[model samples]
Target: MTTSESRDEAVGSGDVDFDHHSLTFRDHPHEALAELRSRGPVLHSSAHDGFWVLTDYASVFEAAKDDARFSSAESVGIPASGMPFPILPIESDPPQTQQLRAITMTPFSPGTVKSLQPDMREIATELIDAFIERGECDLVQELTTPLPARLMLRMLGFDESTWRSWVERVHLVIHDRAHDLDAAMTAAGSLLTELGTEMERRREAAPTSDLYARIVHGSVDGVPLDDVQITMYGFLMMLGGMDTTSGLTSNSLLQLCVQPNLRQRLIDDRSLLPAATEEFLRHDTPTLGLARTVTEDATMAGQSLKAGERALLMWAGANRDPAVFENPDEIDFDRENKRHLAFGVGKHRCLGSNLAREMFKVMIDEILTRLPDFRLAGEPVRFSDAGEVHALRHLPVIFTPGPRRK
Candidate 1:
């Protein structure tokens, strides 16, 4: 067979046409990714709106690290122009990006995250307690969705009463492309303005120990942050802490429920939570891939990319590339060199990765301890669009409640 034919056979599955698939790439893009990896570490696909999708782990890592050559200034999603606003740090490159990331990362350091562990566990338990008696509950709604939102609100000093509205606004911003971008942008802008005002009010009244205060008064390079910067940081933090954690928690729970043997093993040995979390991230990262523009003409994996052309660093595809990960399809909790690009790589690696890991660790530990026998209610599954992030619109499950503690 010709090289192209072999590559096509490896990546192609009759379930979905790579040429026509949009929004929802395929029922199983991972299978296609594996096939592509076999044919060549990197191959341009008709997918991703005809832009090059990098499927090899090493090349994806290289692209993520070589930010000078590949710029992140473009829109993250398709259609390019309609995104409401540039996701600060994420959409920025170089000096400005570095400064913003430094400011944001300060409040999310390992110590700060560790300090919040007790609070996170308390929140998880409180949510779990509410539903434990029912013996059957949708873990996504009951636990996964609220835990991160509540944590972020508390961190930012926002009222819990407004969590639902904020969640809806973020969802609309991220998922509802049908809605007018102007309207969504206006709504998000107004919401952040309100948040900023509230933050300023809190600062004037009495300095409070919270992320909002830190940002409102914090400085980068001897210059304090302005209202706009503070607002952008607040909105970005809220969205980042909310959606990604929710998606990860829901996805991990689904995996546990479906794999009874794995679930039992985890329950028997709680120490496995951290490794299991890493494996889950490697297996199915929430954010699929990140985009970057070629700053200068460059060759990648033997293909020439022109200046100003866009390329996708497929994190999900990379994590599953057999070239770096042996038996990439399987979820091996004990896999050595568990350095997965689920958190991206280089300067743009997620600042909240530590917090995310902690959140997942706490929630998974609590769930396995309290609901060891948790099982799916009926084919507990995920949404159709597994593109940007592998999220579950709904994850229904049934579990035998654990023994009541004194």
Candidate 2:
């Protein structure tokens, strides 16, 4: 177990020194997770006032589905997001999760998400047009970041120009939380306030098809959603929508840089992208893992967990479990069993998964078509946090200057 600080020193002799947010974990997460999995499927970590780490596929998958026993109502982050309100959907259990999810799931349905292809392509083209002639651009800033942010803004019924602030606020809250907890909470609070204001505006405006309108006008069990519910739901949308795809796409692009053969395969045959997308989602999972609170005393993988104890379901590690995925470390687009928990499992699965896949495919298609020879211009600067969304802060790439589609 190689780390900046020795294990005993970090853990104080009694508990396992498994700080998910540690520098070692951040730098080489797969290695860190593999080491943890090697130890056992369920190990108590001394980090963040102690929590159980579920590493294997069975434990994580089972726990994810058993929300009755492993509740999400408490906190999804190990250190607990000190937000005054729940993030909605993901932070709630069963009945409430289902109700809240139903409100926003309509727009993300396969048909609806598929209909947005043209719009996504248009957005992708316009973004690429801004940088195609430059020969080099930070992919994160120039493409990966704004594409989703702009689309999320449109969905939220907000002005596209405000994407930058929304993106920054989301990044600060999710990606930078491990570094500065206070700043992250502050950003979360501020974003909630901003979202609340937007919801109020939506209330006065005519009925629209945007997400904000859906939440503002939405009802659960025939009762209209309250202001807090509206804001929290909208806040979840802002966080999940803007961050995950950005990280997944940016991370996949980095993978292409190191694996030239994979890049060429994609360039040669565009049909393989859909499969590749699944593999990438599995291999470079964006939301590393989420925490679950034990509803009652239960034994999982033969480990006793008392009531109220916290357990971190390591989704990334589970995806790579050799017991489920053969040659798990290697990238394989032809993987027949693409049933990975990258978006999670059971009732709490990512509601926007359909849109996320479509977004990834569209962005990849546009980039691979326009910039076939793209290569890493510089090292990618990854976010320091591994507690939630495992994302790259910046990914610099260069390619032969080309003409804009627009």
Candidates in order: C-alpha RMSD to true structure: 4.8, 4.6
- CA deviation > 4 Å runs, candidate 2: 1-15
| 13-132 per-residue lDDT for model 1 (tens digits) | 311224212443535667767666666665555554556667788889888898888788776554353544566667778777788787657668999899999999888888888888
RMSD of 1: 4.8
Q: What are the clashing pairs of model 1?
A: 286-389
Candidate 2 lDDT score at position 284: 95
TM-score of each prediction: 0.88, 0.95
| Candidate 1 worst ten-residue window by lDDT | 1-10
**TM-score winner:** 2
List the global CA lDDT of all models.
0.74, 0.87
What stretches of model 1 exceed 4 Å from their correct place? 1-26, 45-50, 81-85, 178-190, 402-406
